[model samples]
Target: MPPSSAQARADTADELVTALDSLESLTSTDPERALASATEVEHRANLIGREDLTMRAQLVRGYALDRLGEVSSGGRIAHEVNRWATEHGHQALLARSHLQLSWFFNMIGDTPAQLEHALRGLECLDEHAPARIRADHLQTLAGALITNGSHEEARTRFQMAEDLAMQGGDVHLQIKVLNNRAFGEYVAGNAQAAMDTADRMLALAATHDFPLEITALDTVASAQMALGRHAEAERTLLSAAERSVGSRGANGEPEAQILLTLAETQRLLGATDRARTTLVRCMDACEEGGLAGVRVGALREQAELLAMEGNYRDAYELHKVFHAESEALVSAERDARARTLQAVFETDEARRESLRFREMSMRDPLTGLYNRRFVDERLDAMLGEWTASGSPFSIALVDLDHFKQVNDAFSHAMGDEVLKKVAEILTSAVTEPAFAARLGGEEFLLVMPDTSRQEAVFCCEAVGLLLRSHDWSTLIGEISITASFGVTSATASRGSRSALLAEADRNLYAAKRAGRDRAISDPTSER
Candidate 1:
């Protein structure tokens, strides 16, 4: 006999496994080539009808897409693959799929989805899952946690990842985890600790790993910036950005972030013209590379610089554009979360877990309002409904006036009380088809569906007046609690959710400029 069919199938599977192994080496080195190779593997696996091979190929392909700045596309692929793996009852595939999805969201600045998906992946990992996969999941989850302001838990996760990576003898995984740990330290405001960690990491990666070294340098620059060493930060960031030149995903992403920081440092050093040039360069790079997060940063920096240059009108318009882009980024992340949820909610166990996770993730832990993630998703959905049904909707961006003074006079604890009190007011005020959410510190997004701009303004004015008149002395020792509101309605002029939110943000900025403790719906209206 020439060959048995079973033997031939076994040989083919071996070849595919080897191919997958080889392709992974190209991920940091040559992501474009890795993407092409992954496509080939997927094609062959589909023709062979090998579910295992298909899942493996898809995992790598999704990773490559994310690396190439196609995060949304990669997330969709990961979601579909996860659904297939679940249907096939392949536990290892399921874990890998979740891991890939987690990476996609992480790349796009979606920390909540990153943490949730990473946890799901870790939960699915069994003995059959690779040690490397387990380590990666732990590292990513730790990073997401750190970004979400969970320092202690993130440190614990980072330690676990470090231990796992050490046990597996994977230098790459160890270096990646170390970089994240350094960044975590920086985020915790420990500039000295972060610098020390990054220095050690730089030494470790100096000889063998260009990508890791670049990341370490970025960390060092961040710590320097935190420590108020603008000149040192600028020099370090310039070096990192220069070295990042040929490393598409590995270095390109950091280069963008580094450039933005470099520009900020330049601005702080009073090199206004130079800062503008650097920001322009950053914007161009981000646009060409499709780095949405980086682009938003560039826009914000440029707008700030414009304002500093006494170009108030241009700065305001630029800030409006920045707000629009930022909203789009948030919307993209929400869509990614929706895809992950769709893949997960296929079984009773998964459905229950998802419900619990959403309850935790969607609400701001401090204020009990819907978080920015929820706000973005809801805004996008409402915009779509408004477009389709000719229904009216409006948004108000509410920001507390002189709130920092209260925090300084009392404490953040008292400040938290104030926020909670405001949250309570907004929650109580909102009725059916209307909701409120905390956008971030000292800011809230109030949305009203099926309501005109005029009606929305009325509600916002009432809230603003209520806040101005609220008896905050009982909680924070006689501090005034006033808020400024910006109101905008869905209109043909605002084509997208981002545009609509941007309009509201512009109006809000106008309200603050005129005077605090007021609501402004019309941009042209005199104060």
Candidate 2:
């Protein structure tokens, strides 16, 4: 006999709630998947007229969205959810909702808002809130305190979180708090304490497949580097990078940092060729992972390498590019922080100014495509979402075929016109949910979220055909422009965003090697 409708609905609601609670485990590791699951819960809960579950799902969705770089979108949803949770007297939901808002504010660099929401979350915590929720709230409060320059209070909060984790026997949470403690110690210039804490974190992380393992290794490597133990630092970072190979990597930061530091160690050892190789690898990973700031580090390393090789002109050029890009990035971050304030104050003037500054900050100044900074942030967000939810995303690295010859044959001014036309064609190929960016010089990267490898390959082929058919002679008589394309896609078992990108870069290189005016995609790696 089938169950009654009431029984079925009750069972379904319980199942969703269980799933919703489990989402916390994946929140830091795979926000995309969490968001997808939360959205599913919201839809099903709404279908059953379960407002409580729907609100709960919405709160989780907001948190996931905030982590995945949709901070503004998450902020709005969290605000609504918080109000609903408060009015309904749902203490647990209210605590979690405040936690979500805190995360959103933290992402946008609004330290005050982060602290406010974190305190609010603590205020709402009661017996109704789970132990894990309380632990998370304490961790957020600690971080907020640190941002507020209250180190002693932050240390106390960390201790409280550690106590809670210990009481709950949550190895994962314990490792997380330990890693934070190590980082805090390092930042406070207590290298020895940081090393000891990192060792403890590593021991705990090794006993389980916790997400903090790579970060613990990084902490150890950082302490070693500070102590001038170059060989030790190099070995530790190598281990960290190896572990990071198949992971999402410490909220999207550890892998690149590990490799960058490893390269620095090699450079210090006077291993010029080895250091150069590592820097190249670092640059590729940085580009693929959309780690623009880390890419700047890679660029600086490369510039240093060139200077050591006595190639002063190229070295100087790279340094100049690095400085300009770094300043632009700082300006962009400041504008983002301002926008967060604007949202809070409900000021139209601040909003308008922020919009203008953002546009200026993201545009390439040439070709009008998004710049490297925008692409990096978007890629980081998309990767977090894709990794979490198992959604598909494709990336294409496009290189203009014979671009140098174009510059040599025609004047640089004429070559500029050709690039502009190519940019126009590339921009036309991307629609909503698809974006293209100039990664400086003659290369561009196109990203399509919710697109599979096959779909992306088809799009790349179409772009190729369009360029081949374009009337380039109209701009420069008898001269034609074409691009080499390489494509890769995300999958459930994908190693890292950098690996996905490196695969695409390899394929793009293959496209160029195969004859120049064609598109080639990594065939074996698709899901």
Candidate 3:
């Protein structure tokens, strides 16, 4: 070839490499940048009549679109790239395109498409691709397999990725592999193992100053929460949230997740108001980020709060909305799975169905508020989800004043009537989307998912007034009931869910000490 021709070819090749690097960088952090770079490369390749460069550009653009949440457009671009690459015998580019397609399917939660593309990518690699790229491809495959509930296969793939990453001396790839392995461990209920892996990854990422270290911190928090180490979990989550908040755009999701966790811890501590405030922040962040999954979670927490506040009708409505959104996401995945299997069953579908059944069982027979078991289970789940999402929610421990005196003054039948009437009055008075459950013996627990401290106090006061005013008919004459409420909210100072609960319970006793019909709010002491 002439010198001029050779220089032109070299320039074209350099442009193609630059486009690929830019696209890869954008894949993790900025989809818009990736799309712009890929488009520029595509234009240049077309001008130069370089078919291979054009194919690569098309694949990069498709991957960018997929990350931007434009599934259909990205899929079409991937199809075009596949066609061109196959026609041009560019097997490496074709393999990468397939890998991108697999990731797209995974993002949309489409099991069948994810498996198909992943398998195709593996076949094309055929033991010849660079170790780092092959390891990445395997990691993706492991994630897809894990999501589809193939735990054993996922583990093997993750292990293979780890081995390859270590062999290639790729710290970033190794971190990713460890993170995925931790997820697999979590799904398999090996909480301790998961935590260990997450801790290692977080340490590595932090030491290396990895930009994506937040992900490892998030995983560690999740594992800690699952293990019931609420204090450690909250601390980890808050640190992650702080890091996320300090970062650029769309960083609020991690903060929201952490706030949700703090809320749950507060709720467990009996700081109903504090939990509510945390949840409100979490919902707001999710809304700002346009994170549909997080939004659904926030709504579900809101419904739980409403239920705790005795607004069963509204709670039921909100629950329906939450269930619908969750089902829609699952249905989309199911449709994609159905395309390849005779039948595809999701573990979550069965688990959620069972949960609904259990929820019904936990409802009080007469009052419809949650029973003690329900209260415990709901609190646990709320705390776990909040920790993962980093949002705040709160709880209140309430008790009817002088209940024994009322029962003694009237016949047992009349006492039963009194309890029923009191429950009804409470149900009607505090009708926010927060949750309320009867804890037996005139004690009640209320959960405020997304309410602030002020709002929670207002709610408690409202409930108190309604109870004091409710007319109770007895053989002696008409009477009234009174209740004392203790409220607390989530805070960095509170060590764990139990400590938060203890603090709130102490405050509740303080209210009782001051008088039977008052409310008290306080944060956990500095012990």
Candidate 4:
């Protein structure tokens, strides 16, 4: 006998609710059961031609598939849902579908697709949704933009999302948006700003009772680690990890991000064994949850830890996989950048050619001196070489005394000539094969490849005297300039690049303190 219409409608609604409840439960603790429930719902919904029910069922199924590491298949389903929602004028559903699809693409390292979906979701929300949906969409879009290397724009979007969320009284969304903005700031080399933002988010998270609180604390810890606040990072991460253990069975992205933060903080604190163990645990959690992207991130962190511990063979094998992932992400970013530049330049070939020239122009035009970009690249290479060769090098930081006074007394053009002359004089003073770079303004760096403390000191002193002795022909009269030099030699046992720079800067300050035209060398300090 056929079922009555009222009974059929009731049955369908009851079944959908049951499936959704089961799926939500499994999303945190048992994905297999959730997947089974989702599959049944999907079948029933399709038979009944209920679009909303079908979409919800598909969403749950896609999420389960993603957890099971079937990312491509899951992403296809998400895309289909997104397209269907758009075609049917389901604005809210369409926005959510695009947001989920963006995350799906991000899992596979398809940054362009991620950004496209995020932007589309944002557009949908702006055009037809409420403030809450708009804020959520903006947060997702900001995260995608940050991942794709659009730091400045991502920051603005994140801020706007946070403000909107706060105005709408959505503390959860505000915390999430703040965390997203902090990550962008960290990557953009603004560690202090990142730390500040993370602290604010953590405080806000604490006032709210939500799962996102744990995630926000983890972000705070990561920011603290980046800013060299290791003790604070350890404390924050420990608290987050402890809270997260209760929810570890969940297959949520936040859990993975928190675990990765804990592992990274451990690694930064030189607890290599602990870090490796934590990373392995994170990988296990990711696999269990069927979170493929998180698993990939855990793998990359494990590889880095192995590399740090001198397990190069194992690290290299892991890095091979990491390289493949990185290349995919980089290719997407390059394509996006290319498109953006093409819009600016009009011609594709011209844009490509201009990018090539811009890369080469990273070096200083005057004095044939390496610029800041070259210095950063060379420092990385130098560290690698030193690790292999066990050779010592010395770095001398030179600053001209009262440089602004020279420009004020003479014409600005003449000041440029004086700087050029000073560069030439310094270059001529160093007899050994060394690297000289202009570090912006009147600051310069000279790196002696294989020099001892005494030799480096002598070379720096000679350069200081050369600058003091050079006479500049100005319209008013001939003038002489003096420079202060600080010399710090690199040792095989030095901590890091930043440490070396700090030591050299300290000695340079000492030189200036002693006198305006003197050289200071500190060979006893091993900083």
User: What is the per-residue lDDT of model 4 for residues 188-292, given as tens digits with 9 covering 90 to 100?
Assistant: 888999998987876786677555556567667768887799878888877877787755543655667777877888888899888877887788777777666
True-vs-predicted CA distance for residue 193, candidate 3, Å? 1.9
Would you list the C-alpha lDDT of every candidate in the order shown?
0.80, 0.80, 0.73, 0.73
Better of 2 and 4 by TM-score: 2
TM-score of each: 0.59, 0.60, 0.57, 0.49
Better of 2 and 4 by lDDT: 2
lDDT of 3 by residue, 1-527 (tens): 45697688788788687768657756666777878888988898888788788888887787777666566667767766776778877788878878887776676555555766786888787577778888988888888767655565577678789989989887878898998789788988889989988888877777888765566777777788788887777677667767777552434565676677666665554567877887888888877876666777778877877777788999999999999999986776566544422111235643563365355457653356777777666676676665676666667788888877866777544665666776776666555656778776578887776665567778889888887665565433665678899887666665256765777789799999997798888743521
Give lDDT: candidate 4, residue 414: 65
Q: Considering every candidate listed, which one attains the maximal TM-score?
A: 2
User: Which should have the higher TM-score, number 1 or number 3?
Assistant: 1
- Runs in model 3 lying further than 4 Å from the true structure: 246-262, 265-271, 289-292, 305-527
| TM-score of model number 2 | 0.60
